[model samples]
Target: MFGIEINNIQTDKLFDVDRALENLPFLLEGVPYTLLLAVTGMLIGLVLGFFLALARGSERRWLRWPARFYISFMRGTPILVYLFVLYFGLPIAGIKLTATAAAVIGFGTNSAAYIAEINRASLNSVSSGQWESARALGFTYWQTIRRIITPQSTRIAIPPLGNVFLDLLKATSLAAMISVPEILNKAQIAAGRTVDSMTMYITAALIYWPLTMLFSALQDYLEKRYNRYL
Candidate 1:
């Protein structure tokens, strides 16, 4: 008992495991909405990106120039700005979208610009001979695209598209700004109540990581399956 003060000097841990565990269920409740936004956005990106790819690659200036402008604009702008414009600015134009809808549309269309480039590159990766052979077999242009080109390009696009989806999943956290009840949003609410922002935000990060891993595993499986086609 000679001048010992060990417990007094022992510091508080930065991460409060107990608090994180307590908030686990609340954070989990936000997962469905997060996934919903990511998946819906991805679907939009795929559809719009395909058309954009076709347009961007077209020989016609009318089609190609407009596509180029769109891709350049989206790629150049910050997605957070885009989200704000859609969610906040649109009300002035009498187009008020729900937070979820705004987040989905913003993420989707913004992602499409990048996806279009991926699609274009994937399509180009298919040899010109594939097209020739398709035509030689009396295949219509659409038939050749549908029967031969799509399959090969799809296999090539899977990896990049997976990256896109993964990014979309993580970026959904930004939806909190617009008041979407995504994981980060939930974390913010918990932080306000608990006054332990670090633990709650860390808990949100932990939740997002698993969601990322789950999708990443799915992406890996798809890549392997598509690899079999080669």
Candidate 2:
């Protein structure tokens, strides 16, 4: 094995910092795939989640029962367990999907359960009187929801939804378990080759930390904007 020249290494440079900086490009390379998974999962979950939230709030027993059941099932199960089943068991049932696709579907479905509950709670937080007033003004149920409920619920839900997005970003790391070459996956490869576990992980954190901070700042800005109306 070729020995590293310790004397050639700059005494002024911290080994960890220097190694982490050198591995920056490898970590940065995983950014796109991480964002891709997070965005895809969040977007798909948003639509399904809103519908499930609406269903959870429905007066109709038919809609309510199924929505409630779905939420209960998903919320009761761990996301990793859910993904394992989907990734491993589903193919046995003829539902074949690639690892990346499975990760997207799995995360989206799990997040939808939580998102539905968050929106439902936000919907409940809106005053019943608001709905009554809308109905008195000859608004249909849909019109009342569209005009009054949704706007208020959206304002209330933003912080929680943003928090969910942040969670989704972190959760994308799990994609590596299923062979998705996300940030952690690439970091692992680099670490294996370089035998520098500390440096590789540090590099990954450098990447993840800034991305988390960026979303956190956006969440704060939106929360403040909504708070102004309050």
What are the per-residue Cα lDDT tens digits for candidate 1 across 1-230? 67855564523555799999998999888999899989999999999999999999999999999999999999999998999999999999999999999999999999999999999999999999999999899999889888999899998999999999999999999999999999999999999999988889989998888889999999999999999867
lDDT of 2 at 100: 88
Clashing pairs in 1: none
Best by lDDT: 1
Deviating ranges (above 4 Å) for candidate 2: 1-15
In terms of lDDT, the poorest run of 10 residues in model 2 is: 6-15
All candidates: TM-score: 0.94, 0.89
**What would the per-residue lDDT of candidate 2 be over residues 42-117, giving only the tens digit for each residue?**
9988989999999998999999999999999999988888878888889999998888899999989888988999
List the global CA lDDT of all models. Answer: 0.93, 0.88
**Alpha carbon lDDT at 168, candidate 2:** 96
Candidate 1 similarity to native, TM-score: 0.94
lDDT of 1: 0.93
Instruction: Give the root-mean-square deviation of each candidate in angstroms.
Output: 5.6, 5.9
